[model samples]
Target: MEPDIWGIVWLSLKVSAVAVGVCLPLAFALAWVLARGRFAGLVLLDAVVHLPLVLPPVVTGWLLLLAFGPQGPAGRWLEATLGVTFMFRWTGAALAAAVMALPLMVRAMRLSIEAVDLRLEAAAMTLGASRWRVFCTLTLPLALPGVVAGAVLGFARSLGEFGATITFVSNIPGETQTLPLAIYSALQVPGGEAVVTRLAVVSVLLSLAALVVSEVMARRMGRATHVL
Candidate 1:
């Protein structure tokens, strides 16, 4: 691969990894709430959590820009208070990817949490375990497979994110130009088909690898849960 292609690959990996890292805890908490909570507006919260799945990627990107752009309310506040900015930066690209990937992560985790036997949690609670302790010792252990699956799904989604990323951060090479953006950029130039093809192959391979790892981890977790 060309040095440029390597840079794109590295950037894509770094961005996706960062996005998933940032999203996992939040996604897990949301999934737990959706799977177990019965508060009012639960349905509304679920819809909002999954809104990106139904909305156009570009639309989601536009919303993100409006909310996180340098001049936008949240963006302005962050910048003014902390001297942090995301506009047209690699961090912005990661944020966009995280938004695009969040629904998948939440869905996987919710399903997994829902599948956990409530009896086990109840039994642990009855044994004088605090809710947090029970969750750490019982619920979370049983949900590990699902969490892993969700992380893999989010990572794969982030790796392929294009419209949101480009709209949120633009295609600046060595900065925000991730794998998908690199491929898109390559396609615009004369005799760039080779570059596009190479990047496409890399993208496909990365996605496939993530899926495979997720499947294997899920299966292992399933087997372990059954044994427990």
Candidate 2:
């Protein structure tokens, strides 16, 4: 492969990896709450968490832009407080990918958390263990496989993310030009079919690998649930 192609591939992987890493903990927290929390407006929280799944990618991207653009409120706050910027940056691409992938990650993890025997948690608490301790020692361990699966799913989704990323980050080469963006760019150029094909193949292979790993983790989650 050409060095340019390699760079696109690497950037895609890096963005997707960072997206998943940044999203996993938040996804897990939401999943646990959806699975176990009993609160008013829980349904509303779930709906908000899943809004990205129903929204058009372009719309989601646009919303992200309005919220994270340099002049936007969140963007201005982040820049002013933390000296961080996401506009037209690779980090912005990762943020877009993470938003797009959040629903799937939370759904997978919620299923796993819900499948965990509540009885075990109660028993642990009965033994003088704090709620946090029960969560860390029993709940999290039982749900580990599902968390891994959710991360894999998020990674796959991030790898394929295009519309939101392009809209938010503008597809800068060697910066925010992930695989899907590169493929889109290639499609516009005359005689760039080869580049498109190569990148598409890599994207498919990476997505397939992520799916396979997620499947394995899901099976492990099932076994753990069965044992419990």
Candidate 3:
């Protein structure tokens, strides 16, 4: 209803979209490695990647702050080399959301990667394709459905992310106060019941739409790969 409400919705979508975009490829690559590799300590890597899934969001945010805070090593490197900063910024919110969504995305992609027949990849290699080529033509295509599902799931999760985003970026309106933050703020005061109700409806609708779209994308990808 209010312009601020629309602004929050738009900001939420943009942050979610950017987080998913940055995380999707990394998730796919890591999923493939975990699904196929037998290297030592792989389990440790997997656990680390999935840590945010079980950890308290506030704890995750605090860890992120320690790692990317202005005095942190990464923050120093980023500031010196890339002229970039994330602390207290919307980008920090996206990072927190992305980390929170990582486990779901990786799980979907790992399942998809495992579902692909290794024999098909071998067959592709025998046809004079390099390992890279086989991955591109066989493994990746076969895992397409999972990739779409993972990306969509991550995006949807990021859209509603609050605890970590707020902890990392402090929920500044028009910057990091996304949909969930906006809803929470609305509910904090008297006489704002209507705004909160509308935001709740919006949240539900957005989540439902994400689920529907993900299913559609997965089906399309499956058909393209003849995966059923």
Candidate 4:
């Protein structure tokens, strides 16, 4: 393969990895809240969390563009306050991937959190463990499998992300052109089917590897939870 192709592969992996890292904590927090919290506007929060799943990918990308573009409110604020930017940058690609992957990550984690035995949590509290300590020591450990699965799912989703990423980051080579975008680009040119095939194969392998890892980790964690 060409060096540029390798660059695209590396960039895809980097963007997906960063996106999963960004989503993990946020996904866990949202999942826990959705699973356990009791408050007003719960339905609204859940709906918002899942909006991307139902919305067209292009629409999601457009919204991200509105919110994170140079002149956009959040974009301006982030730039001024944090000296960070996302518009047309690799970071933008990661941000787009994270947003698209959030729902799947949250759903997987939420189910895991909900599956935790409430009685066990209560027992720890009764035995003088603080809520924070229970969450850290007990809840998180038991939910580890789900967390790993969620991260893996997020990573896989990120790897395949296309419409949103291209819309937000504009598919600049070596900067924001991920595997999907690269494949899309190849499809547009004459005699580029070879390039398309190579990229498509890489994309499939990456996503498959992620799913396999998720399954293995989930099983191991389930066994560990059973032992506990």
Candidate 5:
């Protein structure tokens, strides 16, 4: 691969990893709430959480820009308070990717949490275990497979994020230029088909690898849960 392509690959990996890392705790919390909490406006909350999945990627990107751009309210506050800027930056790209990937992560985790036997949790609780302890010892262990799957899905989605990332951060090489952005850049040039093809292949391979690893880990987790 060309040095440019390598750089793009590295940036893509970095952004996706960071996005997933930032998203994991939030996603897990939301998934737990959606899975177990029975309350008013639950449906509304779920819809709001999944709005990104239904919205156009470009629209989501625009919303992010409006909310997190340098002059936007949150953006300005963050910049003034913490000297953090998201506009035209790699961090902005990661934020966009995380938003795009969030729904998948939440959905997977929700399903996994829902599938866990309530009896086990209840039993643990009845044995004087605190709610948090029961969750850590029973619920979370059983839901590990699903959590892993969700993370893998989120990571893969982040790797392929294009419209949102590009709209929010633009395609600046060696900065916010991720794999998908690099492919888009390659396509605009004369006789860049080879580059496009190479990047496309790399993208497909990376996605496939993530899926395969997710499956393997989920299966292993399932086996461990069964033994426990």
Candidate 6:
């Protein structure tokens, strides 16, 4: 392995973890709203949530840039108020990754939430649990398998996200340069074939490991739920 391999691996894991961590609770809330709420424009909201799936990655990156670039509304306000900048930074990379993974997260969480038997939640309420408590104590636990699957998949996707990362964060090494970005950069240089090949192998291993982990987690959650 190259001396930088460990650094690359660590960077990928940290960025993907941050992306999933930031997206998970928001995904759960959105999923809950979609599953249990009867609000106007919900269909529209769902469409917006799923839009990134259908949109090109480069286009999504551009949209993120327009919304969160240093001079952009949200980014500018944060810079002025908090003295933090996102453009071309690792945080920007994570934000791009989170956006790219959000659709999958929402879909998985929403499906799991919908599959939750409302009758069980109602039964908990009949036993005098409040709605929020019922969700925490009964419904959320029931759908944890899908949540774990979704989070793992999102992390895997974030690890490979390239166009969005490059467009948003510009591939600064040891900064915004994730595994995919590092691989892409290597491919653009003369006699970089060996490094690119090694990175590709690393990418495949990481993705495969994530998949296996996710499957095991889902199965474990399913078994636990059954045992309960």
RMSD of each: 2.8, 2.8, 2.4, 2.7, 2.9, 3.0
Per-model CA lDDT versus the true structure: 0.89, 0.88, 0.86, 0.89, 0.90, 0.85
Among residues 3 or more apart in sequence or in different chains, the pairs in candidate 1 whose N, CA or C atoms overlap within 3 Å are: none
| Candidate 2 residue lDDT tens string, 145-165 | 778878888898999998888
**Candidate 1: stretches off by over 4 Å:** 1-3, 222-228
> Model 2, which residues run further than 4 Å from truth?
1-3, 216-228
Instruction: Write candidate 1's Cα lDDT for 1-228 as tens digits.
Output: 343888899999999999999999999999999999999999999999999998999999999899999769999998999987999899999999999899999998888899999999899889999999999998898888878888988999999999888888899999999998888888888888889898899998998898777777767665522211
Q: Which lDDT tens digits does candidate 6 get at residues 27-139? A: 88888888888989999999998988898888888888888887689888888899878787888888999999988887888888888898988888999999889978988
TM-score of 1: 0.94
Off by over 4 Å in 5: 1-3, 223-228
Report the CA-based lDDT of candidate 3 relative to the real structure. Answer: 0.86
Tens-place lDDT digits, model 4, residues 1-228 = 343888899999999999999889999999999999999999999999999899998999999989989998999999999999998899999999999999999998998899999999999999999999999999999888878878888888899999898888898999999999988889888889999888889888887888777677767655522211
In model 4, the Cα lDDT at residue 57 comes to 89
Pairs that clash in candidate 5: none
- lDDT leader: 5
Those runs of model 4 whose alpha carbons end farther than 4 Å from true positions after fitting are 1-3, 222-228
lDDT of 3 by residue, 1-228 (tens): 343888888888989998999998899988988998899999999999999998899999888888888988998899899988898788888899899988899999898899999888888888999998988888888888888888888988999898888887887888888989888888777778898898889999999999888777766654532222
> For every model in order, what is the number of clashing pairs?
0, 0, 0, 0, 0, 0
State residue 152's C-alpha deviation in candidate 5, in Å.
Answer: 0.1
Q: Which pairs of residues clash in candidate 4, taking residues 3 or more apart in a chain or in different chains?
A: none
Clashing pairs in 3: none
